[model samples]
Target: MVISPQEEPSPLLREDDRETAVQRLQEAYADERVSHEEMEERLDQVLTAKTHSELASALASLPGENPDTTSTIAAAGGRIHRGGTWRVPRILKVESAYGRVDLDLSRAVIEHPAVDIELQLGTGGAKITVPRDAIVEVEGLHTGWKDLRYKPPRRARSGGPRIRISGAMGFGRLKIRHARR
Candidate 1:
């Protein structure tokens, strides 16, 4: 069965979700986008997904975006990172040890209403989903970095929150699913 983005929690990811996430990750492995070791490492995270958004977020990081990928993830509670170029319809000035990061969220809704505002990292990726009508605001930077990529499954649309990459590391591929509606 297809799980709705809003149904997920945070922090602690569940195991059942791992089953579904593994299937999707396998597609990336098959495409040679990710190595077998990476797949296994990511799969371990998904299986432990406590929230649906976390599971979806993990899936977003996968290499491939095949239509046939099957994912069923469960979440308990924890943190999630949103990745992409930082930009928001409204600008929120943020400063920190890592650096200043801008949030571009004029077109986002919180997949989960009970959770805190969207958190961005300075040099990592994030994956978050919201309900159909909650406006997502920039709360703060969870972490930050350069070079972010997000690729979602065929049935999904919109990438999650955007993050600014430092561009220090060589170019790499990161897939983030912003929205799936």
Candidate 2:
């Protein structure tokens, strides 16, 4: 049976679905399937998409996503940096020993309503950058000889991701900051 556009199933797209679509669009743009202007336009639509059909339309002609993946990064006496238009995993574990880590999630495509970040900091420091609209909560944070510093979100956003960061820092600093627009 052929379904008309109006008759198509248009379930509401969850925040996670929208994020995934945005990530796919970004990948398409990077692969040159879509132009810069088209990517920006699709991204805007994805951010404001209200229904599954709308989100699907935004990612139309794009490549399919791979299976869900998790990432773990360990730094030993070196610097670990993750930035650019990468996909944010549902769970991320970072371990640093006498090294530094920088995780920038401003342009990341977050596929979950809540992202879990586990950090193991030792004589090293970490800097986490997130979107200004995201809600960030650092729990069970213990720092010795340093501090975990971040300005509490002024107000929680309805459809933004929540970053739950929990970890220990010894002789190191953990700073959570908003991304510069």
Candidate 3:
């Protein structure tokens, strides 16, 4: 839904919300949807806005992240880990043949309402830590040796992150968990 000009952001808006807005602005700028000057101006507004309408105003005119954009991280062997604060891509593919993969999304800037993660692993196992409210699905995943180590919530609330995981792996266990409150 579009955020109208007069609509105010919640006073309880978290830093994560602001960071998501900023990430979207940067994505739009990178795609040439906005000129450099517009990017700079909106970035200033986003950085200064705190429980203020400026944040909404700055983001009101920007388009959402490109739906077709996909990013990949590949490791021939060793380890691959993503944590801390990072932008969550609409689609992400991770591949590793002989090492562990640990991805922690508890503190990520997830601009999109849904995200897809495709994994290809071997021997070393994997662990994915998602936001507490994320709704996760692994219907299309195939594991060679062990069953995936994820248990979905009985019921998920509306309007949280939707994560779809699909891929194939051999000789490793895949584990998923939501971040603790």
Candidate 4:
């Protein structure tokens, strides 16, 4: 057979080399780098991608960034004080291995003069210490166990910090203490 100089390669040959761009995008999403909005947008773009190059481009344009571990640790390991009823809009995530969280924020004073604390923990222990004279009112406490312990009160309202500990995997101990009366 003789080949013609004007002949061209078949376009169907390129289809076998096509990449699974949508699958790659899903993998990126599972890695927790891409936001929900970005994931949805990329998925839409990926579905409309006609060629491998176009799909690859869409994946490359995604703003997928991993979380910084140092900053997460610093945020998880600090103390905050408020003069009035303070509210921290964050769910503390402590690993099950650590099994213990010790916070010393008794110096915090609220407008009602009552220290209101709300501890929401998973499968770990929580021990919070307050000032001996500060009034303690625990709004809610959720954990994995029911081993709630409190130190003897030396002040008028320091007898015991009002608390509420409850959760699905409650298997931890909670202790409260104060030095002065």
Worst 10 residues of 3 by lDDT: 1-10
Cα RMSD, each candidate: 16.1, 10.2, 5.7, 23.6
Q: How much is 36 displaced in model 4, in angstroms?
A: 38
lDDT of 2 by residue, 1-181 (tens): 1112343333454465665667678678888878898889889988887765566567654544442565788867799887644567788888888888899886555667888899888887889998766788888778888878898767654556888998788888888987644
**Candidate 2, TM-score vs. the true structure?**
0.62
Task: Kindly give the stretch of ten consecutive residues in candidate 4 with the minimal lDDT sum.
Answer: 1-10
lDDT of 3 by residue, 83-176 (tens): 6445678999999989999998865656788899999887789999987678898978989998889877666656668989999999899999
The number of the candidate with the highest lDDT is: 3
TM-score for predicted model 4 compared with the true structure: 0.36
Judged by lDDT against the true structure, how good is candidate 4?
Answer: 0.43
List the candidate numbers ranked by TM-score, top first.
3, 2, 4, 1
lDDT of each: 0.38, 0.73, 0.77, 0.43
Clashing pairs in 2: none
10 residues in a row with least lDDT, candidate 2: 1-10
Candidate 1 residues 70-178, lDDT tens each? 2222122232322221112222222122322322221222222222322223333333443222333333332233434444344533333333322221222223333
Scored against the true structure, residue 46 in model 1 reaches a CA lDDT of 71
- Tell me which residue pairs clash in candidate 3: none
